[model samples]
Structure formats: structure tokens, C-alpha cells
Target chain A: MAQGNFILREKEYLALQASLKKLLANSYAKVVFLVDKNGSLIASAGATGDFDTTSLASLTAGNIAATGGLASLIGEKEFSILFHEGERDNMHISVVANRIILVVIFDRRSSVGLVRLRVRRTATELERILRDIDAGAGKEEEGDFEELTEADIESLLK
Target chain B: MSFINYSSREINCKIVYYGPGLCGKTTNLQYIYRRTNPESRGKMISLTTDTERTLFFDFLPLSLGEVRGFKTRFHLYTVPGQVFYDASRRLILRGVDGVVFSADSQLTRMDANVESLENLQVNLREQGYDSDRIPLVMQYNKRDLPHVASVAELHALLNYRNVPEFEAVATTGVGVFETLKAIIKLILIDLKKGGR
Candidate 1:
């Protein structure tokens, strides 16, 4: 349950990148990414070369949402951390501030214990940044978008 | 909810196609997936049962060429419409920005259509979204069927709020893009008011 209508700003994204970098450095994970609860990739740090993160982000959100549903059905609040183990690659998905998801994808290079410990520390900083961003979001900024004409929409129809 | 990525110069929106089971919601996504250019569309993923009934959801990410220097991406998802899959449907609508209610046009499925519409409203509320405030469009599908109900009748029954209802035979691609475009238009208009 991310705050409604998430708008990413450059300043906030920079801060997020810094946090994600800290997590990856501390954990030695292959990649660390952040996705809104609704499944949008807010930012990613570390190596994601030649990978399709859009689909990954969408499916990650779906997996977590379904897990949350299953949690509530059994009278639990939420299953905060989801980990998938593979022969070569593993993923750790944790909830941040109940609004965003923090995912750390790694290999045998890092142990689950290390990723978990680093994520716990990183989540706090990321949550603070998200709260600040949400506080400043949704404002009709000056020239936020170039004025769209009916023709712009019509062109899409074509 | 719409996610505007300033860094990527992109705006992403989630649009869900909701309806009773087998009411052409999946077909709508298929047709759009087929018609779109390879560069602009991502792989269409369908999570389904062995019988091909949508078990969880179908996700299709489409890029409508950049508008005003920002790429507009619509992540279209279809909810599992079976009555037994109510919990899955609620999860899919959690942060949806727009909804396209695909109603079955057959007279025999009239009650199912009404029930699904009401179910959608209830699910939206449960997710903390106002059904009235969210951008919504109605598509009376399977109109090519000989025994389908008329648009007027579907309107009287399903389109209580009169949200830009369209008559679509989704299998053949008729009115598919139109329904999609209409909802995106409404979403963009709403985005203009408050979205930065």
C-alpha cells in the first residue's frame, strides 16, 4: 500500500540510488531494486545488465501481493520477507514501510544472513526517503508537463 | 495508481480488465498484444489453469510512443474472473489506476455481468479506492454473437454511472483499442489535475 499516485523526482531518486548502493556494497548482492507496491520499478542499483527488470518488477509485486492475501486469510498481518533460492541465483524481497518493496538478488557470493542483515539497516533509510517524497508529491508543479492538446491524444488513437 | 518516473521520462499506469469468467477480458489483451508493434510491446504473460481459465492474472506491458517527451507505458492486467477467484481479483485491483469492465453481451450471462460489476465496485472499495473517482470504462463484449444483448440494455443495467461504455467484439479486434484508449484518456485527464 504505497501512498497514492507516486511521482519520482530526481533528487529523491538520487537519494534512493545512494541507499541502494549502500545495501549492495554491504551485502555484495548482484542487484538491489526498489518497486512500488503497485509494481513500478522506482530505482535499481548494481549490475542488472541484459536483464528485463520491468517484467521482474511486475511479477515481484504480484508475488508479494498474493502472499499478503494469503497472510490475511490465515489471520496474519503480512509475510514481510520472501526469499527464493536457486542453484545459481537467489532473491530476497522485503517490505519497506509497508508501502514499497526492496528486492536483493544475489548468488552464492552472499549468504542469506548477510543480505537480511544489510536490508534491515537499508530499509530504514529508504523508508525515510519515501516518506519525504510522498509528502512533497502530487503538487501541480509549474510546467510539470508540456500542455497536451487533443491532437496529442488523437495521435495515440491512430 | 500512475507512477511517473522522472528519470526514465516515463509514465506508467496499471489498467485492469475485470468481468465475469470467459467474458473476453483475456481476448482483449491478446488482440492488443497481437496488434502492437514488437518494439512497443513486452511479452504477454498469462497465469492460467490447465483448462486455460485465467488462474491468477494476465499482464501485458504496452508502450504508447512517448507523449510530450515522456513515454507512456500501460501495464494491462486481467483478473481471474471466476467466482472462486474473488480473493485474487481483490489483489489485482489493489493499486489499479483505471478499470475496464468487460461485460458479457449474451442474454444468458446478464446476471453474471451485473454480479461481476457489483463485485468490482465492492473490491475497489475494499482496496481503499473510490469506484466513482477511479477512471473506468465499460465494454459490452461478444457483440458479434447472434443472441447478444443490445447496447441499450447493457447500458441500462451495467453502466449505472454512464462511464463511456463501448460495444466491443474483442476476438476480432473491434472496439478493443477504442476501449483501451478511452480509459487511458480518462486516466491522463485525471493525472493532469494532480499528477506532477
Candidate 2:
């Protein structure tokens, strides 16, 4: 067990990977990434080298969290989706299962309408998989994690 | 929450530096970002105001080698410490694996320190994390200041559970890594216990 553990077992991982891949195929987005509400990168598929995916995941969670705050201020239950459009890139972020967030980054090649349409279909499937994953993970998320050698942890320091 | 990427062989943990406004929470992250090798650290991002006050948070992504085959990545963040930013503070604590309360050592700021500590507990509770059980550390910062609270006094007010505490002059880097290591060590121990 590491800190902030969000365990996705093999079954869940495959399902998430497949869902992401499917989303990318059906949509015109450059990347389809999934992030936990805590800003942890769950699964990110498609090309994502324009920016660090890890950083993107963290900031996305923060963005969603901040937006949730704004929603509270406005007396809304929650803002389930966020859209940020840039000159060169556009992003669509949707809250999935109230626990995870799905982000679709697109370029001029795609329209928000198409992305939203595909996302609407994929989101329901993603949510179903997520519920199953949570139920399956239980408390044994890292039950098989072996104790690490000293050299292993020390290597990161260097 | 810790995100495990078996495919990438990585484990990501979030640790938040929390305290009253201007309590050197951001300073600690800047020191760490400065000291860490660029290869092992991501770009430090600060969401700040025109006055450079941390408007949202200061994030520094650090990769501290690996455990077993998994790279241990720690995302260190500092909440907007001003009291008025309570909403943002609670948001930052959502998946916190550990906390470092950077209490200002100035006697005049004692009230702010105490308030921030209480706020941390309340915020953590809102996120379903027990402050007592979480891996938490305290750093009495700005110890070099002329008028500062005594370690005993600060401890009495802040370290209610008597967790590992340190004296820090964050500007000069004193006691920064020591406090960080203490909390990281605690987090690793908890992780070994399956994060119970």
C-alpha cells in the first residue's frame, strides 16, 4: 500500500484501458485520459506528450475540485462537466461516477459536439466499469505487494 | 488517494503542506524543487495571485526512486493558507496521504497557527480522513525570527498528538527536508500496513 491508494485490479485496468481506447477511436480527440477525483492518474490513453500526463492529472483534479467549490457557491449539486477551449487545443472534462474525471483533449480536427456525443456513450460504460472496479478492489488492493529492497527506494533519491 | 500504475510501475501519493497564511508553506516546496535534481522532479507549478500569494496551490511533483519495481512519486501541494480560502483548503485535502503543518513560530501568529491546525483537522474530517490516524508532521517555521514562540509553547498548542515536530527556518532550508523525511517515513510505514 502506498499513500492515496486507488487500486484498480487487472480486470478493472483492462476494462478502463478498453474504455479509453474505445473513446479515442469513436471520438476525434487526441487523448482520452481518466483521473481520480484526488488528482491521481488512473488511465490515460492516446498521445499525450504535449504536456506531462502526471501534471495534467494533478491539475485536472484541482480544476475539478475548484469548480465543485464554485458549484456549491452557486447552489448547484455539482458541475459535472468543464470545458476549456484554447486557440490550438480544447479540452472536455466530465465527472465520472462522482469519483473519477474523464478528460478529452482535442485539436481543430474535432468538434465539441462529436466529442460530447462519443463521451456520453462512453461515460456510462466507464461508470459501470468503475463501480465494478471499486467493489472488486475491496481492501486487498496491495495485498500482494512485496517489501522493497533498500536500493529500490534509494535509487529515486539519487 | 494513491494511484498505482502497474503498467508504468509507479505509485503516486499526495502530501499537503498546510498552515496559516504566509507561514512558509510555499517556501518549503520551493526549497524542495530547488534541491531536487531536474531529472527526478517535474516542473513546480504555482497557481498564485498578482502578489505571488498562493491563490490555489503550489504543486511540486517529485519522484523518489522506486520501491520494489514501482517508482514512488510524491505530489507535494500547499493550500491557500489564508483563512478566507477555507473552501480551497478543503478541496486540497481530498486525497491527502500526509500533512505537514508549517506553523509560523512568531508569538504574534500563534492564534493563526492554532486556527489553521483546527481547520486542517476539520478539512480532513470532511474528506473522511482522521487527522489522528493520518501521517502528519509539524514544522514550527521562521524560528530565526526575533520574536518567536518557544518550542514548548508551540508544541503545546499545535502538537496535540505529539507527532514528530521540527524547528525550521524555511527561507534558509533548515529543517525542511528533515520534516519532509519524517512525514514520508510515516507514510511509508502506513503504506506497509496497507494504508490503514
* Candidate 1 colliding pairs, count: 0
Candidate 1 residues B98-196, lDDT tens each?
A: 999999999999999999999998999898887877889999999889898889999999998989989999999999999999999987777766532
lDDT per prediction?
Answer: 0.89, 0.86
**Candidate 2 Cα outliers beyond 4 Å, as residue runs:** A1-4, A139-141, A145-158
TM-score of every prediction relative to native: 0.95, 0.93
Q: Which consecutive 10 residues in model 1 chain B have the weakest lDDT in total? A: B187-196
Q: Which parts of model 1 have CA positions greater than 4 angstroms off?
A: A1-3, A138-146
Residue A36 shift from truth in candidate 1, angstroms = 0.4
For TM-score, the strongest prediction is 1
Docking band of candidate 2: acceptable
lDDT of 1 by residue, A107-128 (tens): 9989999999999999999988
User: Scoring model 1 with DockQ, what do you get?
Assistant: 0.52
